[model samples]
Target: MDHREIVTSLSQEQRDHLTAKSDLPGLPLLLSHWGTILVLGTLIALKVPFWPWLMIPQGILIVFLFTLLHETIHQTAFRTAWLNEAVARSASFMLALPADWFRYFHFAHHRFTQDPDKDPELAFAKPATPWQYALHVSGLPVWRGHVKTLAVNALGRCRDGFVPPKGHSKVRMEARAMIAAYAVILILCVYFRTPVLLFAWILPALIGQPFLRLYLLAEHGRCPYVANMLENSRTTLTNILVRRLAWNMPYHAEHHAYPGVPFHRLPEFHALIEGHLRQVEKGYARFHARYLSELKLASRDASK
Candidate 1:
């Protein structure tokens, strides 16, 4: 069955139960995220033996904050509107994504998920070769885009279709504020002659972003460019740790089908639609292996 069939099968009570927003789970999830970051920060601060190894986990934790930011943009991270905005701003800084810009950008993505012509995400093509795949997994493209986005928005060049004309000034202003914040961090690092930001954010983000890239690719990598969410998006079955870190975004199709449902409730949402999902993958490993296989096949056909 398609997404509509699945939705129609569910009773109104079940739908409400799944879509009801609450601050309860979101608060604990927020605390857990901070707790993990704090523990890693303390370890690095003390320079514990092989503390650099902790950077991998730290990077994973930090980079996955993108998922939190994504959910917050949907205003489903918390029941309270203010909490969602606060977390969205914080995550945007950590990830070097301008929240206002992303709000418009992401809403466009949802508005046109797999439309190659309309979806902003499709503007950046997926890797078509092994070398391109390697570069993609290095997370350089994400950083490059972030830098470019910030630079353009800082210059008040927010002319994208997703960002309304009325919002252009506000978007540019927020971008400038973020750029100033980053400038302050840079100056402090130089004045103190310390790599505090380096050890804490930069290196960790660099080391950890590939994981995020990998996870994000599976969301819609080979899905059909159709209006049906189940056919257009993917839901990769992953472990509990990944689910917790990503705020249940692994249930990508469910989220797309019912964006009204909060992150904490995605599991229940998935339970309702699991059998109907068309693009379910067992894991990221399997997803990438299949993606690469298809790329190879396409390359061979193109050469012929």
Candidate 2:
């Protein structure tokens, strides 16, 4: 989006709310991130029998960090933009993702929304004809959704090395710096005898990533796709655990609908637009628990 178009999307009320200071983030956030890094790292080092599987917690922790990185990049999580950027680095370290690269790409998701060519997260696109729609419903492979998130994240790094930053030297440096950071993490895990790769990389990609597909589908799965922000993405009403750990990203619709509004403020935005989001499903389990059943029904009906 050009400068004015982007500015226009966020209503004045939304803009005012974003500037309001709230204690939504406090010591609890800092301690949570610190605790996870310490606990997960120590567990990996301990090398005990089943403890090696501590990777599960470690990987989940990493997703939180990544999500939080998205928040901080937008400076939505803290009063001071500088402090948010500080927090984002820690998130990046935990996830082993290139934070600077993410900061750049995620903004694109905002500008483009669910536009297929412009928006990479456009899993919600609908087919034109009934036959094509049937193919889509049938082609929705549950496992592949998860698989694709990881595979794409892996492929993204290479492209990120070259993706132009928005004329900011700091962002450009951050891009290069993060790539180097990831490279260093890999080299250390491989050479210095750290199990970072097995725990942080392989297990998460193998086990945790597939879980993302259901969440992805719930966010903006397009039976109807349009510029209406509410229609394009979903904001799952998560349990406290998922809400806290996953960094409130379950508020996917709100995030898309208003990119400048940060995670802590998503609830306010949701309440502001409550009348709007009632139809778009919330809660991960509520949406996806019957996905397989729905698929079966769709298939049988199509056949008949």
Candidate 3:
């Protein structure tokens, strides 16, 4: 069945149950995520034996906050509106992403999933060549784009069609505030002659970004460009740890099909529509391996 049909087939009671929002499940998960980050950061700060190695997991945890940011923007991470907004803003700052701007951008993506002309994500285009794939995975392009976006938005010159005029001021202010906060952090670090942030946040985020790029690519990469969410998005069956870190976003097709369903309820949602999902992947590793093979084959075909 198509995505719309799948949704329509669900009874009102089922729909209601799936869409129900609650903070109970989110709070503990949030605490555990943050608690782990805190512990890792402390270990690094103390320069424990093989402390540098700890950055790997630390970076992964920190970078995965993007998932939290994504969910909170939808206001489905928690039942409380304020809690969602608060967590989104925090995650945005940590990731150097402006929450207000991203909300419009992400909403447009949902509205026009895989639409080459309209989806902002398509503007950058996915990596086609092996070299390009390496660069994409390196995360440099996204980092550059984020820095540029923040600067542009801070100047009140955001030209994205998705951001309505009413939100321009808010976006601009949010960008400016983020810039100012970053500046303060930098200034304090310099004044203290410390590399605390460099070790604890910056390096780790950079180290963790490639993994995020890989995970995010699986969400829609190579999926058919169609109106049906079931066809246009991919659901990667990943491990429980990854699911916890990503807030169940591994269920991308289920999400695009029924966005109102909160993250905590995604597994249940997946079970109901498992047979209907069109672009499910076994795991991220399998997806990337297959994707790489396809790229190589395409390169050879083009050369011929």
Which runs of model 1 end up more than 4 angstroms from their true locations?
none
- How would the candidate models be sorted by TM-score, starting from the highest? 3, 1, 2
For residues 26-88, write the lDDT of model 1, one tens digit per residue.
888899997888888888877899989989989999999999999999999998999999999
Which digits, one per residue and each the tens of the lDDT, describe model 3 over residues 90-161? 999999999999999999999999999899889988989899999999999999999999999999899999
Clashing pairs in 3: none
Overall local distance difference test of candidate 2: 0.61
Top candidate on TM-score is: 3
Model 1's number of clashes is 0
* TM-score of decoy 2: 0.70
2 versus 3: better TM-score goes to: 3
lDDT of 2 by residue, 1-304 (tens): 3223444766787688764654457348757866876677676767667875776776556554656677778776777767787888877655545566566556776777666677655543543344544444443342354334334444443333324644345444554565567688789878888776676445654454444444455666542445666666667787878777766777776677667666777777677665665335557677654554566677788789
Q: Count clashing pairs, candidate 2.
A: 3
The TM-scores, one per candidate, come to 0.96, 0.70, 0.99
- CA lDDT of every candidate: 0.91, 0.61, 0.94
